[model samples]
Target chain A: MMVSLRTKSSFLKIYSWLPILALYISVLNEFDLNYLNLEYFSFNFPFILIFFFTLKDFKHFDYFLVFIAGLFNDTVVGLPLGISSLSYLLICIAAAYIRNITIRPNPVKDWFYFLFIISLINSLNYTVLTLFFSFDLILMSYLVNVFFTFTFYIIFVSIFKYYMRGLND
Target chain B: MASSRDDFIIAIRSAFLKKSTKQKFSLLTLLSISIFVIVLSSLDLKVIKYLKVGINEIVYRSSFIVSIPENLIKNAFIQTTEYTTFFNRYKRNIIELENLKSNYVSNEIIQFENKELKELINNYALSSDKILAKIIVDHDSPFLKSIIINKGSKDKIKIGTNIYDQSYLVGRVIEVNYKTSRVLLLSDLNSNVPVTIAPQNIQAIVTGSGSDYGQIKYIQSGLSDALVDDSIVYTSGTGAIFKSGVPIGKLQSFIGGSINEYKVEFYSDFTQLKYVFAEVITKTEIIKPEEKVAENNDETNNPLNVKLKILEDELKIIEETNRKFQEENEILKNEINDLNFKVSNLNNQISSQKKTINQFDIDNQELDFLKLNLKHGHKCRRTFLNTDGFIVGTLEYKSCVLSKGANDG
Candidate 1:
């Protein structure tokens, strides 16, 4: 059965705000499965979620709520308070720019654009953390994170496309 | 070219200034806020610090609650892995337990002695009480290794408080709230511990590698050759941050190109942490006996004064021992005097008994002589029939009577 909000139940109401709710939970919980013993394995779920939903211009995905989620992410991850907020808002701005520039939405173009944006953002994150905060971060870890998040973007985007199709129905 | 530039400008302006009906804050406004928050957070203002703590308190508790399902899954995965190696782990644990048991008694003694020695070296002695804190959130993030514990200022958990997983150094509390705190695990890139490499006696800084282990950094030049594989690493208490002699990890040397690189495999596993002990230390100043005199010399921070104070302490101990020995000598002297008096009294009693026995022997001899005289009196009496008779009162008469009695018999 196709899932739509026309049924007008509490579950449907929650379904409408699922993307924002997911951003909150992801920031709060950091659903990364580190216990899988994958030493070099991590992906930024919020980055993917924020990029896709903002690029699509989903009505329930509020920018303020995204900012709040960024604050929560900073608190949970023990980064200097606003570093994650900055990184997250930067992601939003990048997605918004891409969304405005594109008339014909092509997955291939968006995918390449995402790679560039994330690279810039990750590099910015590294420089800010190291130079300003004096954080001793491994450059290689950042590189690996960028690689994994970039690779997993395609997979999550497909799933998100299905979700969007269901919600639109 | 002009049309393309205009289109680019329009897109950029739309992205920055445009807001949808559902969005409250424009992208530019939020970006500005993000930068503002970053700058404010970097400042050490009291308002920001408290604000950060408040945010941390709420966020940590929320994260803990939100993490329950994921934690359950994680625990299940861990338990599943544990079940796979149940017997092997059990066997290894048993062996480790046995080794630990044998070392435990000695370790306790050493710890007690260490407290005493520390007290001797410093005027204030630190007594630590380890409070158990449950780990509420441990995500093991790749970028930052940290955990949130369900203990904070309310539980006397302060910033810089050492966290331990069964006596092994796990981390230190970097942020403390009212009901929760954040511990920067030893595996975090930001963590730096001053450590002493044992058997080699080299001091080095062990910084987190953002991995499961630590990397040994800032060793004294030319001393890297002394470092061997499997050397014990422990906190040196330098800079007075971490408690001294706490076991941190073991050094593993990787030999490669021209210079050897070393890694520290921590004793406590950062991923497997569930509960940790937060050490709350209280320092009590030792009251010196000569403190009255030394009140004028209150420069306790000075090295020379400290040395002098240690010397005074040594002198006081020696003087106390001498006083004890003097008291014992006086008791012994009194005991000897009592023994000597008893010996003199016993000698007097022995002399009196000897005189009484001599008198009794004399009386018996006189009586025997009288009886012999009576018996022979008739034979020896100055009668004409006895030619050898003598006067009774004379000594010669007695002899003659005795001889006559013997002859008749």
Candidate 2:
């Protein structure tokens, strides 16, 4: 209920500059920046990690935020509206609810949660799309997307949280 | 309480400050994530389309690729649906063909029966000499009203052959090919047949005047006796076009002019055509008048001819008288026919009048009898009592009672 002024200002700086950075990266993403093909996963993960780290106290509204993000994806990506929305909401709510219920959180626990949430979202998205849209959502393709995104997000978010701690000091 | 209130204000300000930064970062991060997903999804879709097209092309190029188990399975699914549709169409066609075949066979049998009946009837008409030709095809030309028969020069089908179906004369063969002959029907523009007024001996050239009903032109004068529905016009075999006595058609009803050159009606049903028979030329016999005269002179020189000459002179005289007599007889016969017809009609009228007179006489006699009874003092009596006393009372009846009795009687 009581958020500090310093935390609030840091959050503002992260959110305000975040879009310009994301947009620049998106333009960069158009280039096939295969740095050993790790960028493929790193591309979407960094942005999502930044968003995920913003979930501090009001974790209940995270799925709603993810749902809005999914809508934007639905329009821009031309995917079925409900498909990505369902997957994003599933991941956000699960992460947020677990964070709320758990008494303690560690890097290992965070990584596990992150991996599970991404994989669950990707696999469910694939399955739903394949069944309803009559597309062949091969398991290998879905796994590739999930693992890369998870690895990149975990690494990036860890590094990001560390830098934020310095800013806090 | 004041310190606590100040702390509460500080708390509210801090809350707003935290939300402001978080909201900006969250919105920015979410926007970036959404764009990232969209681009990735589009790339994936393009790759999928490319892969699919490549696979299809490989399968198309190599039959071996198409024959692969997976490809074969896919093809079988597609082909089975196609085969089911084609098989249903084939089955329907087979059923329709079978139905048509049955009807065709029955129609053929009926045709055979008709042909047999025709042959039987034709045998009666030309009992001694007759020909039968099957109708192979009939190209009924509305423009020409002509029919082409299958018979040709091979079947001795010649020009001037009397082409007749089993029923009536269709036409004579005009143009003959090796296998086919064209018949100029009596209804054709350029076709004409010399038809005679039957039983009346009045002849007319029934010319085809561009219609199914022919024009009976060149009818000799003084032939008004041609009655409607009277006789069937037959070919006179004069022009050697058609054989004599081929039943062409019957005289249908016609309007006659004062000049006796009336239109002869024909009953030739040209519409119903099937088979026709053509009578061929038998011999090339040519006898001129001069040869016949020389033959007569040679025949007169014999001894039997001397006696025959006397008989011939007498025959000549008799022939002369007979010629005059025939002329007179024709006039007299015509007069007699007219008189007889009039007499028959008058007899009918007289008989009818006699019947009426007899009825009137009977009525008059009854009336007179009623008057006599009334004069004898019969008065309004409903009934007469049979009394033993004679002439005790004369019963009378009213006119109404008498009328009722008359009706009852």
Candidate 3:
């Protein structure tokens, strides 16, 4: 009985680290389903995952790990080494600021805050990639990405809440 | 108001500098490091380049391994769709194969002739061997159309080396690591290919439309009117960036009010690419016999002798061209002689035909006279019963036979 309990706790510990694992997997796999043939159909899954976990102040979500994931994303997507890192770090900062300011956390408020943060971050990404790095990026693609990321945030947040509930149990 | 402002400042500072127990670095430090890295990357430092190559080599391999499940799913989806349209696609492919088979010989001949011409103009021949490469990462990013391949500088892949899907131009290598490279696809907004629109032969530049298609730019103002839909668009080899005559796409014209737009429908689908060929080119310089002799005599270092050798090569080329022209002239002269002989044979046939027609006419006249004699000859007969009849075998008798016995009068 004691061994089974220990195994159960071990499984819970692993389960608690699911968000970071998902971030790494998303970056490596480039979770965009391009086979759908939808034009401008990409969403920043890592951004949503990072924002939600950072806002919740999840214990296992390490800042250094997130930064490394950003670098991996840049390598995979052929972007400059630090471009994604900058964007991801900015997202974490925004989520942290929001978490610090809120006295009572509300899901609706958080959802709207995610929209504003993603829009600003995506705009900054576009500006940096275009003006600083001289990368030719379509403004429409960035806008579409922002839209999809914002829309999918609530859905992923609910699923994450379930995971958190299971971890609490 | 002062308390609220203080609270705002405290919250901001905490977000920037505060680190929780699980977090090692403050968000502000990471932010600063990120910005610094971005600046360094943009500066193109050599150390950063090697560091990036090391990071790319590791990350690309890991990404490829991690991507296996997703790639399998993608392949399954594609295979499902392919199977659904299997029969129709097979039918279409069969017809296309036959048409391509008919054109293959002519295309080879043209390719050989073009190679010879290019070698003649430039003193070196470019021999290219295409090495097949597997795509390691194909994320199909919304903002950037690029892919990572498994072949890189280790395989002699240089930046700007042309990548192809079969004979169709796909993209070019933009970044090369030790064993991996990134290809900036032609669908990227930054990619520009110098192309010739065929049938009209208008030269233009094709820039990516940030979509699957490309937009035609830098063309003459009124030449757009001459561009027909489905006209071939191929690289023109201008600026020596790409080899000439590599097929890119076909022209698609769209018309709006007071506007004409032309797009290129790429021959190879960038999304469907699984493996690509990277062309590794080697150039070999052509030396003339005179230049070889000069080299053997150890006078190759003399500039005057080099110039004379070049002039001699030019003279040899001119003489060769003249010889070809003379040979063509001789062939044309033989063709003209053959045509003249045929004309003489036809004239002889015509004269013999005319003689036969004259004989036929004479026979017809005699037959007519015999028929007339059967009916009206009794009145003009030169028998003893008639007083003014001529002798039977005389010229007058022959005249009488011809003129219906008018001489009997």
In order, candidate lDDTs are 0.86, 0.54, 0.88
Best candidate (score: TM-score): 3
**RMSD in order of candidates:** 17.4, 36.3, 8.0
Fnat scores for every prediction: 0.87, 0.00, 0.85
DockQ for each model: 0.58, 0.01, 0.67
lDDT string for model 2 (B332-391, tens) is 899999999999999999999999999999999778657645653233343355332224
DockQ, structure candidate 1: 0.58
Query: What's the fnat for candidate 3, on a 0 to 1 scale?
Result: 0.85
Specify the CAPRI tier of model 2. incorrect
Clashes of each: 0, 6, 0
- Candidate 2 docks with a DockQ of 0.01
Better of 2 and 3 by lDDT: 3
Clashing pairs in 3: none
Off by over 4 Å in 1: A1-7, B256-259, B289-409
Candidate number of the best DockQ:
3
Flag clash pairs in model 2: A12-B21, A15-B24, A15-B25, B250-B267, B378-B396, B379-B396
Candidate 3 lDDT tens digits, B1-409: 9998998899889989998788999988998998888888888789999999999999989989998999999999999999999999999999999999968755655665566566656777788999999999998889889999999988999999999999999999999999999999999999999999898999999999889999998999888889888999999999988888899999887875778777999999998999999999988888754557766887565778767766775676567666666876898899999999999999999999999999999999888777656755555558778868776556665566667644433
Residue A148 of model 1 has an lDDT of 90
lDDT of 1 at B272: 87
